[model samples]
Target: MSDDLIPGDESSAADAADAVYRELLERLGEAQPQPRLGATKRALELLGNPESSFAIIQIAGTNGKTSTARMIESILRAHGLRTGLFTSPHLVRFTERIGIDGERISDEAVARNWDDIKPYLAMVDAELTAAGEPALTFFEALTVLGFACFGDAPVDVAVVEVGMGGAWDSTNAADAEVAVFTPIDLDHVQRLGKTIAEIARTKAGIIKPGAQVVSAAQHPDARQAIVDAAAAVDDPAVFEGEEFALVQDAVAVGGQLITVRGRAGTYPELYLPLYGDHQGRNATLAIAAVEAFLGGATQPIAEDVLAEGLTEVASPGRLQLIGTEPTVLVDAAHNPHGAASLVAALGSYFDVDEIAFVVGILQDKDAAGILTTLAPAASGFFFTQSESERAIPAEELSRLAASLDLPASTFADTLDEAAEDARRWAEEAPRRLVVITGSITLVGEAIEVADDREWKATA
Candidate 1:
């Protein structure tokens, strides 16, 4: 709320660019469930179809898409290929949504691309208005920017994480060489569909002719939908537990080491620095995707490269331990399934005397379902709101937490204060932990603050 808190460029001042972005998203939400791909198509046309400039890997799922895309990008780079990764719902910086060879797109680069694309965005809006159609959405504009950035980066391959569902998502403009699915579930019901079969049908829209498809183990209906989709295009399909699987997974002091046996070959004990047993499945899916994309290459990837690449990749806000002694675990679990995974990971991986949580859910998410899963594991709850306006108010979230019989407190109207309170509560208990979950917006804000502090110290 302070003037100094606003971001600025040389010519223009920032009055909550974050707030402006959130407002745009809110406006888009007012028009949600518009599953038509026209806006994306129009935006791509105005931008000269930049997504076609490179080979692409399209990844889609209800959960784990970001993690899987990051892993696959890392694996491709490990093979000595220049890779570009485009993902969504960034935890911290907007530049995190687009990266090349593990480096985030520079702020200057993003600003430059924004300048380059602004006029096209205006034209698209004008055209849509002329046609009496809804204007380009925040996600649609951002997806165009992603394509432009990747086109400018000019990497050999671009790994795109589908925003929302795969079929009508803006990123679907690109013809991907491979399509990956990571355990589809019922999350985005309104836009995608109500049932698993219907949702799978929408997600399966990303599959193109002759593209190799690699999917994690799926619900029966979902799996059948994917099968039907691939068969329609004559695509070679690899399914987890049938064509590939995690043969073994073990945790150690360093991190998780998982052996993934794909249809092509068995990847032995790939050490990933990420925590959680769920990550084992993610790593296996990444490996399977890489093998499918490589098309049976005779040259084997060096063990050192695979191990080093897997171990070194960074996935923030997914069971990240931010503070020691009264430990703080920050995870972006925005839905029931994700919250369940976090609960399982916490119980299996960390040993602590007590667990406290700073929890908040957005209006669009499953608040009751998330709380139902998290409250059983959490000893205390510090309910708060994310920076997003769509965030459910703290009092409502507190009431929801009360339904679970969890000791809960609603803190100062914001996530930062709630996180501080959680930290304070954890400080009082021996071997205590404070976890932040339920929304990526909260995770992003927390990580941005941590990074800013680190930079100030070094500055």
Candidate 2:
């Protein structure tokens, strides 16, 4: 517990570090939930305001946030700018949370930086105790560490993914030159408000005073909330499909090809290698954000650089195909809105009679809603729990899927076994698709198993 002690100084150092990080995360879950706009500022104030050391592109929404953040970072990097990207809920290693110069920060870097920041963390804890306040949660500490990493590396810009709702989320502490909103929907009713209006209001909190706001096309109510929130901050709002638009979208050779028209300019034949109609919208937001970041200081963006940038960007787990021949696609569609998008994209890309599905979900998610959207397109369900302690139990999830009168079965705790079962069942023909979805954790596990099995190679 002492700051001077290094968790991994000995043979058990790795385990000790894991234990420390786990404890931090638990404390973060237990800490007072700020769910408002200024908690980040308080945390940053305690940390010497490292968040202001660099410019930022702030992204918040119910979905596509990670993709949008990656797209913006890629575009910025292609323009010869050194960029730092911070995202969350890693698919594999925890180090995926921070990317510098388009690569995951090295494990050595994570450990060394964590060790260096432990003293600051201890100080923060002591101050909280003295003030009769809860200690910094794992997320708060990690947010501080990101600022430290970015400041230390001294990247020109940082693309920050909001941990949860925008306003009170810890990442909001950073000053953003451009605030981007991906679509908003009902999720995280506990921390964020339940209604669309409430969720929209909470997300709109990221729009800073004088920042340029670029948003994915939103529902009318959500759009209004953003408008009102921007007015309060006196920020200029660029509404997708209104202030800017993607005039054309189609499947290109490398990925999706689209054209965007901003308020003041137009970009043609932009190639983004990600799939899905939603990505087209996400790409437009990214383009608008890049334009906004440039501050009209440059003429229209260089098309050659933009094309290369978009083609090189990769967002794993969003309609990602992990195997072929009874193709296995892994999508992190944990909610109804995302599930709907996944279904639409599948419809666009593949034609199959029966879609076999492996699904595991968290308890906080709308299980019934997600199932409803996916069940119609599914032939059967292989139910299991993903990585969250909050995940719905396998049997219970099966029952929920069965209540919809869809053929469903529960699996043992191991994702590897569950995925094996799903693949075997779908192997009557190689083209019969197997889909593992619901939570990113489950998809990650499935991907790991599929990799070990060489499922794609054999398929």
Candidate 3:
């Protein structure tokens, strides 16, 4: 199963990569994640364990994992290291999930890696079927693909983000030198657990023996779970609000000016071109995670190099401005925690007095919690559903809004219609903004529309 790997012809690379991605989609979807790593581990083992080829910084959390991982990869790349980043639930294309040197993994690379790894992946799939188990899932196969691509790139370091709860997440197959956690909240409750403590313990599984741990501040139960996990491994841990912190953040023109006390150094008043105070905290964790990984939480990052990295990081679909004129924006805030952050950012960052919300929630998410969180800030709701099979219908959101007595809202079967209607409504009023939230899928589609229509250039 090892390489006699032939390179793919570049002429048909896009078609070939699309076919490979479709095959991955044919497997179980990411929403139905199998809580096991055996299949992925087997596939990687056949590929001669490419996950071990580079140093890893595995991230686990309810939110901010992608943003944090992106920041970490940017910082490491800025320091002149060849870096690989693996994130999940791509907004535009599958290629967005894997990054090499701060750029998307190319179509050519995807096709080439799939050609090399397909034989090994097929071998694992056959083994599982024979044993009366399912084949590798979408996430599981994608996990192997990310590692294979990174190994082929032969990167200096890889920043890996967990697709779900840490214990059995396919990415956890890689033993990280630094196991990092963002705030553990009640997301994917059915898959992870019902309570915060249970979820935190499962996420803390990334903390292997001899691995260093870094974390954001957590609730008491979550904090204890991480502390226990680290103690059990006898590894050192540095928690946010204790070891390092987002010392200060103020609204800046494009984003924010922030100060961070990293594990090793203090980076004062850096310009991060991203919205939200949550993002400032996410950067703080990224800085500390990098400090812990590169310098073992002892040696400070050069201030100029650190600033260079922070300024270059862009996390699309999270509090992003997709349009202007009528001032349309999108935030991938699927849960109450994220929705709350969006509300706070709106108050702190923009001058809008009222917001017309375009929201879509997947079937498994807590729609009520999200609606409740946004209700206080909403001028009205344009209830809509994403194209995802998991998305709840637009009427469902309308019904939820009624149940909460929030407002009289309108429903749109398609995102485009909802956005169009919302924009028109916003344009008629002063200090009114169109803000899309409640799911990544909706936000991604909104972004696609914004790009196609040239929303920034035209009204």
* Number of the top-ranking candidate, with lDDT as the measure: 3
Per-residue CA lDDT of model 1 for 1-459, tens digit only, reads 223332445222233334335544643552253566777777777788888778899999998998898888888897888889988887865667889778987555566666677788888889888998878777777788788888887788999998888888878877899999999998878777899999999999999997999999999999999999999999888898988899998887756879878766677878788888888899889888888788743445567767867987878789886665556778999999899899988887888878888887889888988888887787878888887878899988888766767665565587767877777787786888888888999887777655553412221
lDDT of 2 at 360: 93
Candidate 3 lDDT by residue in tens digits, 227-280: 999999899988999999999999999999999987787889999999999999
Give the poorly placed runs of model 3, Cα more than 4 Å off.
1-11
Clashes of each: 1, 5, 0
lDDT of 2 by residue, 58-171 (tens): 999999999999999999999999989999777875668889999987544555667667776777678777887767776777787787788778799999999988878889
Please name the candidate that would achieve the greatest TM-score relative to the true structure: 3
User: Which segments of candidate 1 are over 4 A away from where they belong?
Assistant: 1-33, 296-300, 407-412, 449-459
Q: Which of 1 and 2 is ahead in lDDT?
A: 2
What global local distance difference test value does model 1 have?
A: 0.80
lDDT for model 2, on a 0 to 1 scale? 0.81
TM-score of each: 0.90, 0.92, 0.97
